[model samples]
Target chain A: MSVVPDSSTDASGVGADPRTGPAPGPSRAARLATRGIPLLVLLVLLASAPLFAAPFTANTLSRILIFALFAVSLDLLVGITGLPSLGHAAYFGVGAYTAGLVSIHWTSAAPVPVLLAAAVGALAAVATGWLAVRSGGVYFLMLTLAIGELVHQLAQSLSSVTGGSNGLFGIPSVRIGGEPLTLAGYVYWYVLAVAVLGFLGLWLVARSPFGATLRGIRDNEPRMRSLGYSPFRYKYLAFVVAGGFAGLAGGLFAALVRIVNPSDAGFTTSALILLAVVLGGAGTLWGPVLGAAVVVLVRDTFGPQLDGHGPLLLGVVFVVAVYVLPRGFAGLAGLVPGRRRSTGGTA
Target chain B: MAGWFDANLVSILNGFAIGSLLFILAVGLSIVFGMMDVLNLAHGAFFLVGSYLAVSFVAGVSWGGFLAALAVAALFGLLAGGVLSGMTEPLARRPILDQALLTLGISLIVAEVLSIIYGNNVRSVPGPPGLDGSVQVAGSTYPTYRLMLIAVGLLLALVVWLVVERTSIGALVRASVADREMVSAMGIDNRKVKFAVLGIGSMLAAVAGVLGAPVYGARPGLDKTILILALVVVVIGGLGSVRGALIGALVIGQVESLGRALLPELASFILFGTLALVLIIRPRGLFAGKVAHS
Candidate 1:
């Protein structure tokens, strides 16, 4: 019944597989031109976006950045750690709710709510991750899904706290040093700053030694175990960190949208983020971010114009992407000029 | 004790009624996963299709009309299942998640198409004229349709059990579940078996949808709700086991009804709490079949 080949073989071949392996050495100038220059250019464009773009366009871009962070956080578990979670929005929703409640009842101070959201998100992950990490593969997916649904139910039933299906509304705009960031451009800048930090944190974790250990576990748990690494501990930590980042994204989301609803933490949100991760390429950090942008554009921007048939288009994308873009947009990196084609096909 | 029984008797019966409906829906999911290694996420969409068909063809109609609706829904489900099976066949060599996502996509499209046709309003199907009225049961008034539902569910369960446990074709299905390679080695076309299982499983889901229409009503999100419930039933009962599906569905049914009656505040969490508890104790479920090789 098992379709997966032996883990040993998979681990041995990982280095040769272009999708999972590090690129062969390139000169510093070439690397600078290929990676650094494009990243810098993109950052500059994003920084200047609100200056030139319309208010509506700026607002939509903020949403994309928030979800891009959310998707990248998911990539930590799914792409790097080899754990495909379907309920990640649980933490994201928890973070959003925390931010909303804090902003409403305590302080609208921007950093305070966002920080608390991240902390609470980590706590929620620790609470659920212990049980979820016990199982692997599809079972893990199902367990996380159940956990997500439970959170959604809690959000719905705990009306006094979460405001129930009506959602928690009337949240004040986030304040910076006692002044509210009311304008769309100001809010966009705030969101972009936080999102970039969250992305960098996740990117660092993915490149760190700990991240490599996670990749080891994903490729072959038994080998890692024999090498004296506790797979569970590493996996649990990754899940917590990812949850924290997801929460950070959620906090950003609440600040931008000023409303937190049950659907924010529901299965649909979780599934959409998962689809983004897959569509962008699971393990590629930047790929999922791109996927998130596409997904957000399709559902939020183009959806209204399509007579609310955005989901139909999304569904078609899910099917078509799985079949045609198995490696996602990240897999097309080799097609660029002056880039060497990666050895081997799909992993 | 008698007073309490009188007060909660309706809830208990409601449990059975819902349990029977769940069994019909989940058995197909359980067995298909076991035999074909495919998790048909579109199972709920199939159920939704049936409920809508019930709304269109069975509501306010005669008994013959309701029966004809069931036949039509079943046939439609079979065809849908066949197409799904074919779509998923090529992805067999890939990860199971691919198949899951594909089915999810199909379900999304189906749901979108359905909502477009039926609108977002909640549409309830009424029982046939003869079965629509209330009848006395143990000194309490109850809907006659529910009692009939219980009887029908029990009869269907028996038929399924007998077919799976006592018949030759059932043996083939069991064998296929245990070891597809060995069954294929014996010259059986595993693909045909898979196709049949998918078709039959889908048919069962649609039939349950029609049966559950009066109780659940046809709505936009009903498909997702039913799908989640069926998934829970399958998980608790042990995937791919008909007997497991029966026990799991009944257990969840009672939990759902009794929880709502007893602790309305925690009603939603009760079912998932049970699932978590089960996972902690026996992650493979209560009646897990032989552990398939990973």
Candidate 2:
């Protein structure tokens, strides 16, 4: 359970579980993150003109951070919960469209829209996950894909409410007290805050008895059931949690973009989220954020140029990541200490 | 009233005609997936190649030359089957997702490479002269080409069913899917068995591509659509059962065709609605399935 347990190797040089370890003290993840300081420092140097990287680049980075949170949501499901959702775009789109629609009609109380987006995402997740988590691997994947597409098709057909194919646009942005926030600043802060809180929250979840039970379900659902634990309940709980987190990411997205296109809920979007999780290493807390960064850079830079050929690249990455570096970027540290624990089990 | 009846009845005929091709495309997918747990995403790529080959052949020679194009496409499929077999045999032992991801990669590469060479445009393969005209059925005029397509498709389906149900090879596939390692231990060259299974499956997909291209038209995203449809067929029919595939295909075909004719607005939801309900009720599939989800 929980990928060989978090007790084996601690970067902090203190044997501590990532979940229960004291928060105020030097954390184990922070200890692990420090191992990549040299790499981060070098990359920071290359990106020296943080101010001059153009509002465009900064805006793009902001979007990537949001996507990273999206991927983290997926990681919550796939990496931790042991459910590889092919329809994560459902929650993401739900959150995005909710924020867009609410702000368009009401345009009041910035927190309300964000709260509503997460609620909508979680509600949809509860509905879809009830059915989805019941199935095993492949069907679970296909059903999710079908559910995601079903929502997308509905969005297309119900244009009157959904704004149809054109999507909701020209929506108002979030304001703290009647002053508009800087586009990059607002996006950066929101993404940063979500990523941090999300990381800590999930870390806590992974440590709690419930998290341990989820890991048990992931590793051996039948055995856990035999032990008198209803694995289905555990799976349903994880699925709902993942959906809420995914919804949170989607809300931030609507706030940033001010538009919710059909593509937001499309299969391509789901596939991209999968790619980010695979790149970031699924179970690790901060891995998806880093992955979202890589994917964002790739899309912002190469996505336009590739067009139809973009699937080719994403497909290749999916295969290669599964084959070559299954552990993804975060697990790169674990590899050094001969720690082969690569983010949860694959079923 | 009679005139209106005739008008709409012809639409059902057209729907059945279109559905025949869908069945052809989905059949091979159902068999291979049913027998071997491999989800060949590249099946549609084979179809695309077949279509492109047929278009070229039809452009240069007589419409009968389309057969020659099919033969070439089949050969290409065999080569692809063998190569993938050699590369992924070890990997397929684990989970279906790994195989899905691998095939997804291969197909992406095939699509990208082929697009670069052939370019992305809708291309057609002309029908043979004898089968290219109009025909009257039930006091309604239907395109002769479509009527002929329906007949030819039925014949292909019959031939496929006969081979799978009445051959030693079919037995081997049925046995292999139940447990490959057991079949391997039984001293049957399971590799040879699988090689043949994939070759036939791939050829089946390719032939459907060559024949259906003229009707549906070939494009960049055609393969993806075909893949999804095939999966739907397999799931409905139950995975690994040929009869299930056919039943599923026919159900979907009838759904799309009749749904469009009767209720155009809700047409998109018809098949999906069926799928959801069917799955909830009959989680195993239409036909009694040999393998259960792991």
Candidate 2, residues B165-217, lDDT tens digits: the string is 78986677777767777888999986687677787778777877777766776
Per-residue accuracy of model 1 over A143-189 as CA lDDT, tens digit each? 78778887888899899999999999988999999999999999999
Query: Could you list the iRMS of every candidate?
Result: 5.6, 3.7
Q: Candidate 1, which segments miss by more than 4 Å at Cα?
A: A1-23, A27-33, A335-347
The C-alpha lDDT values of all candidates are: 0.84, 0.71
**Docking level for model 1:** acceptable
| DockQ of predicted model 1 | 0.47
Q: Output candidate 1 Cα RMSD.
A: 4.8
How does chain A of candidate 2 score by TM-score against the true chain A? Answer: 0.82
Chain A (alone) TM-scores for all candidate structures: 0.90, 0.82
Residues B184-264, candidate 1, lDDT per residue (tens digit)?
999998788888999999999998888898888899878877887888888888877889899999999999899989998
After TM-score superposition, what is the CA distance of residue A100 in candidate 1 from its true location, in Å? Answer: 1.0
